[model samples]
Target: MDGVTVIDHPLVQHKLTIMRKKETSTAGFRRLLREISMLLCYEVTRDLELTMETIETPLVEMQAPIVEGKKLVFASILRAGNGLLEGMLELVPSARVSHIGVYRDHETLQPVEYYFKAPEDIAERLIIIVDPMLATGNSSIAAVDKLKERGAHNIRFLCLLAAPEGIKNFQSVHPDVKIYTASIDSHLNELGYIVPGLGDAGDRMYGTK
Candidate 1:
């Protein structure tokens, strides 16, 4: 719980409520996803390092503090994460992007990584991994594993919602990495879906079902 930050902002909660409705339209869902992500990004990046520099305003020169170092890497955890990535990019236009794809096997309840690509110098920049739901957390853990293999150390995991089990699992695996979520649900269902969750994030986002 120490490293996990839950964003309870009213705008975020309102958008999440819209997203959770079973009758919400595809267009509405998509738009809300972007809006909620932007809201969450505001909190996620609140502590970014700042460096002071002299800048010329319209009337005079003044010292200002701007975000330091190379822009952060917004790493999407595959297809669903893409939704959150779009909004985060709107907030941090200069941030680099990356992707990691993982699918769950129903029978085995295991995560299968199908794709991964990241910036060559991930270690030199902050990395924020975005995914809408953290249910069982297998895919998230696996995604971070791949990132670590590529030398990414300063990493954060951001999601729209999470289950307590998923949070504990992620923390146990990567205690150093902070987590940010819009909400934390009660538990995961028998099928490994978060109870009362917005349902399959990829399916809902793409209108696949």
Candidate 2:
């Protein structure tokens, strides 16, 4: 809670409720996720630095403010993260995109890395890592581990829902990185799913299992 930001917007809350409903269809869940992700992106990037630059309007030349520094990288955490990526890209079309593929080992509940790709100058840019559900935080923590190993410094983690246990686990390992989310649910169940969560994000979004 200290370093985490809760979006708490009315629309975000409404969409989240719809998503949590077991009866919601795959198309409906994915659509709500996209809309919510866009709002989440808006809040996460709120403090980005801007610089004044000379610009010419149709009638006159003037100075205008524009975002400074290199384009941000939205580092999505595999298949589920891609859902959030869709909405975030809609907001920042010029931003760079990266993927870190990690999966949970069913027995151990540890993160397993399968793929990773990013810009060459990742260290010089602000990177926002996204995963829809921070159920265990293993994937998010491990994904950030890979990024730090590759020289990324400024990083932020965003998600649709977070469990208290997951937040504790993630912040314990990576305290410096900021976390943004729409809701902080009660707790994770025995099966590693967030209680009162929207269920398995990938499964719901893809109509799988």
Give the C-alpha miss distance for residue 179 in model 1, angstroms: 0.8
What is the alpha-carbon lDDT of model 1 when measured against the actual structure? 0.93
Question: What is the C-alpha lDDT profile of model 2 across 95-200, one tens digit per residue?
Answer: 9999999999878899999999999999999999999989899999999999999999999999999999999999999999999999999999988999999888
TM-score of each: 0.98, 0.98
What C-alpha RMSD separates each model from the true structure?
0.8, 0.7
> Cα lDDT of model 2 overall?
0.95
Model 1 segments more than 4 A misplaced: none
Pairs that collide, model 2: none
Superposing every Cα of model 1 onto the true structure, what RMSD results?
0.8
Q: lDDT of all the models against the reference?
A: 0.93, 0.95
Ten consecutive residues with minimal summed lDDT in candidate 1? 101-110
Model 1 lDDT per residue over 1-209, tens place: 68789999999999999999999988889999999999999999999999999999999999999998998999998899999999999998999999998888877767999999999999999999999999888999999999999999999999999999999999999999999999999999889999899999888989998
Query: Which number leads on lDDT?
Result: 2
